[model samples]
Target chain A: MTTAAVTGIGVVAPNGLGVADYWSAVLRGQPAIGPIPDSTYPVRFAGQVVGFEPDRHLPGRLVPQTDRMTQFAIAAADWAVQDAKLDLSGFDPLDVGVVTAGTSGGFSFGQRELANLCHRGPEHVSAYMSFAWFYAVNSGQISIRHDLRGPTGVLVADQAGGLDALAQARRKVRQGTRLVLTGGLDCPLCPYSLTAQLAGGRLSDRDDPATAYLPFDVRAGGHVPGEGGAILVLEDRAQAGARGAAVYGEIAGYGATTDPHPDSGRPPNLRRAIELALADAGLHPADVAVVFADAAAVPELDQAEARALAEVFGPHGVPVTAPKTAIGRIYAGGGPLDVVAALLALRERVIPPTVNVARRTVDRAVDLVEAPRPLTGSAALVLARGVGGFNSALVVSTRDIVDR
Target chain B: MDAFTLAELIRIMRECAGEDDQVDLDGDVAEVDFAELGYDSLALLETAGRLAREWGVSLPEEELTQVRTPAGYVALVNRELAQSGAGG
Candidate 1:
């Protein structure tokens, strides 16, 4: 099958705006999560992306038409296209497509319009509200704005939907499309969003900042919520080669699996997902140098993830890291961000460390990397499991098709 | 009552439409329709709300459908302002 080369990346994480800043912040091991300040919501803290101005990246007309999340997507897509250095002078706009994963629509925009309705009347609501809160607005707006009108789609999977979206984009490229912008975006830090996240009982409610989300250790509570976007430019490997675009890495293989609800007592089949992705990449478990974990920090979820890693790697003790510990989980954006991190790791030949997760209170068989480690191989595994039992894994490496 | 100036009205219309570049601010309303400028019911309603808030007069939703041109829209708003002033 034809593979997709990730030529460029655009990130809007809580800790950083550009992909370069984000990766460096991840390596620095600083926590960006803090108290949400004023509001009376039981939820106290979240990872908020600061210093992002919609006017800075979006046109004046587009600034009002889009919500914060959509703005992030637009900026990210632009950054990726520029990074790829695409000479679209003779290219057909319809030849390209967009696929994005989102867990919820624009919460901040919806909340504002809803407030208008309550205070004034139905007529008081802004006309743009309809599109702003629609879950697929990112994909639609990105396609319309950039004129990438090929096969477009939006995935709303549990958190894993982001990875699933990339896998789908890869499929589109393999089928003959020349370019695909595949990524994930979400911002669930607002009041309504936080309330919903709290309802799921997966967010850290602790008042203490340092101990709120301790994944892989005994003190693991739950994940702190965040908002971010990661958009990638995925091109046909051959086309990318012909264009002489710099390759960060190619998505060699990806696999997805589902499990019954946690109440059903059916844990996720993550081990199977790992095996399938490696096999799809024509690689063995020994070939994978690092693993990016979901790291929900909830005891059961962390234990399950640790067991999956141990089962797959056996005695190899493959190093695992959950760099999201610094920025919290941005739902749909979390998985794609991990894929970017893995790609950068392959490029730098080093494994980034998991931060603020040195909780020694629990013992596990999995080898969690608390510090950065040098790696010998380029092949890496990135995993994401969502609240509703969606599990996804993808294999990425510096190796091109010729090497395979 | 002051007549609706084309510049201010056009600006308001573009604001209500949540668009500026697509709106042909210089287009002859007699020749061009709002539909051609990408105006829709939501924008119309929003425009109506803003107009009512600013001028203390409102247009019936049905009147919006009947008037497809910007000049028609201006005439309707002016007529409503007169009616509201007389009734008061």
Candidate 2:
């Protein structure tokens, strides 16, 4: 079976800007959630990517042409390509593709342009605004930068979009694409986007960062909105081996499903998605070493996720962790970041903690790791749930598992 | 009031989009194509937007599209300035 192997990973999270930095911080259980600087919004706390200077990472010309989200994406993609040690000249440009996910596309840039339009009329608006605020602009800009001409696309399943984007990249790899740059990054901390998020009523309004986003805990209120995410390089396993690329893990299986209508009196299908993903990978639930949880940090939503995991892995059957508790929920970026964390856990033989949840306040049948725990399993399960009923699950396992 | 000079236009162009290392803005670049100087239509539009806000000279989109060089952009902006009684 042809599988998509993760050859490189790039992260621009609030906790860390690169894979090494992020992995260290996650292992240390350092929390990055803090006050949203220079803001007066009710939900003032979030995971902002402080100290990210685009001028240092990107060319000056691209600064004005992109939004913060796209800037992060570009930087992450460039780093991923570098990490993969990929030479674009060797492969036909048509065989390389880009697939990414975005939720609140370029809100800061759009807000600035809208302010200009309101104060100075239509002529004051920037010509770049036409593409800068687009959700698919990340993929377009990355493709244009790398000259990737094959099977590029953008997924918009909110948080689940990150995993869905990787799934799309896997499909592209299976379809004969030599390489794909995939994952997601998001920056929705601006007033315009925050207002939209506030309307959703899922963001925690607490001023305290430590207790603001405790998933599955009795004190669980809601999640804090955050900025930044990760990008990954996915190459065909054989192609990666031929190129002597260092493999992180294989994107072994994927399954996605939408929940039934709220009025249908039916249960959420998160369990089915997990089961399907395991089946796709030809593994039983017991084969999964650990689970990277969605960890919505909302009581009912957390309950639903817990219920799903219990149904599949049984009560306290499998270890689960929500490392995102350290960085808050980053919408589309959160899932890919989780995938990166899972891959690192499998590679390093340690599971990073779900920081700040000292006690399991809720009666969820899953064991939440609060500290760095030694990993003994070869495969990991990553699950993501988007707003409006999008559920996605992906299985990533070591190369030996793939060989088997 | 001051006339928008090619030097000023070049400075603004550089500010809007970084100058290409291959092209020296300090040289005789008044008649050089903006594209050759690494400035695109969007950069020029941004430069024009800045001029409108700072100098109260709004270059129409049609006229702006006709500008292809620093000298042309300076001339168009000065013309708009003269019409608006903001020219030197």
The ten-residue window of minimal lDDT in model 1 chain A covers A357-366
lDDT of each: 0.82, 0.89
Count of backbone collisions in candidate 2: 1
After TM-score superposition, the amount by which residue B24's alpha carbon in candidate 2 deviates from its true location, in angstroms, is 5.1
Instruction: Please identify model 1 stretches exceeding 4 Å from their true place.
Output: A87-89, A401-404, B10-45, B56-76, B79-88
- Candidate 2 local lDDT, B1-88, one digit each (tens): 7788888887776676665656788999889888888788878888887777677787899989888888888888888888889745
Worst ten-residue run, lDDT, model 2 chain A? A395-404
List interface RMSDs for the candidates, in order.
Answer: 3.0, 2.3
Tens-digit lDDT track for model 1 on A6-50? 988999999899899988888777788888869587677788898
| Candidate 2 runs further than 4 Å off | A401-404, B18-32, B55-68, B75-86
Model 1 whole-model lDDT (C-alpha atoms) = 0.82
Task: Provide chain B TM-scores across all predictions.
Answer: 0.80, 0.91
Docking class of 1: acceptable
The TM-score that candidate 2 achieves is 0.94
